[model samples]
Target: MKKIMVVLMVCLMVLNGCTKDNTQDYTKVSNQTYLLGTLVKVTVYGKDVSKEVFNGAFDIIKNIEATVSKNEDNSEVSQINKGQEISLSESTYKIIEKGLYYSQVSKGKFDITIAPLVNLWGIGTKNAKVPSHEEIQEAIKKINYKHITLDQKTNKIQIHQPIELDLGAIAKGYVADEVSAYLMEHNMGHAIINLGGNILTVGEKPDGSSWKIGIQNPFDARGTKLGVVTIGQKSVVTSGIYERYLEEGDKQYHHILDPFTGYPVENELASVSIISNLSIDGDGLSTVVFSMGLEEGFDFIEGLDEVDAIFVTKDKEVYLTSGADEIFMLTHEDFKKKQMKK
Candidate 1:
């Protein structure tokens, strides 16, 4: 009887240990917060995931907004634009440096000083308007990225003119990258950071499979996606005129403005989505590629390393880079995929 009792107890303990291990191996926790005028969500999957982990990541994002956002009254960007030379925090300095780099590399195709044009059109604003020709020309004069000066020695930034700095084009992506790094540092190996439309992943999906991200249909309303990109640990950032626009009479005006024309960008490509290692790179290049149009955009992306793009044209034609075809799967049967040869 004693021998039988000992064997039964051992079996009970083994079953309990297995159950605990299974539960711990696949725990997932997530949280959503509103910041930077959009919904930001952090989903973490690991044995040690917690609400605290998500909160820590959210804090990093909010900190970025407090420093980089022009909307914030005392933000570093706002202070500099107000004609006051202000010293920057580490985060602010890095972002300013990157914005300038993008401006230089894209040859003014993407400019942070294009804020004046953004305000004039105000596509997503309550005061949205179709500005007069003269009004637009005046805004164009102030939309020069070269006017932004950064003194690396003192970490101070200066807007030489009346132009403002709007990092809306790239701030969310940088924040996502920062949060993702934090999660990985703490051993939260598998995580997802969704900042508005910008998404970044720290590792493969919980099932050890490739992660899947959806590309929104430009013609459809929000939540309507045309395709999915099956990727692993990458940032997916999409930019489109369809994101924010205003309709007046029979004409439609989008938020994406041309710094030179001070008007919405006119192009055959409806939207461009970039997938890259860094979210900031993906976000910054999305605007640059969108401004370049379809053909030139392909040439631009092909010159880069480890960056792929999905270009959706105005006529609903989906164009993919050679690398994009391997991961992108069109979920909506209505759209056709065209992968161009190198």
Candidate 2:
């Protein structure tokens, strides 16, 4: 399975400064709003567009976030976690269903019932601290997706045990997908959406060019670009350990917690970028592949269909899968390219 694909021995350099103030096109309309605990930006290309167009698209994101956000006390996910049997909206049910599907496909590598572990770690909050080994062991016991039960008829979600579900990995992807669907329905010629790094392009640019998404340099705190993934009308989502971390003393712990270990996934890869037609798939699989480590991560990607990954090891070596070469183009010469799978 280890075969060399298109290996381009090209010099990859970072862009000096963005020449375009917004997107490459001027007819495209864009709006930014706060949702899903992050900044959500949507751009659409066409004429005679009202503010409601963007507002309507953003409303879908807001409604879904309010439903599944684990932090909200009145959220449906929160209610379900509290042992109350409740019915979910179609949107809510579909995301949880997709979340469970990824969990099963990853064989527990990606789980929605890992909120207990998240709360225990509290990586992004002021409560972030290292918990006792016993506490981690206790949290691990509840990190099973099988503990959640969903009824298709009534659209109800029930937690069998004290399990909690966190849809952070998949929610933004789903939101992006929803926004894209809306854009397509409205016959938007070209658009780009950046929901705090989870990017989705609608159709192509007016000039019919692929969207150049910068893969963030994990080692740089200034959010520098290490490479660019050229894509057209696809979702490019990169998950990294650099985003949110807890610094206790001299050690650093990232937010991507392992479901089985109840700790940050310790691997040679610093970040993993997943590309697919659907942002949900890219979003969910990025974390799963990260948790699987470099060796097993490539194996997992090979078994999948229409999915590609870019692995940036802790040593700064960039690895691209077979199909990844179609979109991934390196921008940093300091990083060496590793041999990819067939």
lDDT values of the candidates?
A: 0.78, 0.78
* Model 2, span 1-342: residue lDDT tens: 000011111111122222254344346566887777566778776666679889889888888888989988999989878878888988789889999998998799889988888888876666878999999999999889998888998998877777788888888889899888987787775777777778788887666666677787778743477888777778888877776777778888888888877778888988888888998888888888988888889888877898899999999999888888777778877788898555
How does residue 78 of candidate 2 score in lDDT? 90
Kindly state the number of residue pairs that clash in model 1: 0
Superposing every Cα of model 2 onto the true structure, what RMSD results?
Answer: 6.4
TM-scores for candidates 1 onward, in order: 0.90, 0.90
lDDT score for candidate 2 against the true structure: 0.78
lDDT of model 1 at position 170 = 82
Stretches off by above 4 angstroms in model 2 are 1-26, 340-342
Which parts of model 1 are misplaced by more than 4 Å? 1-24, 339-342
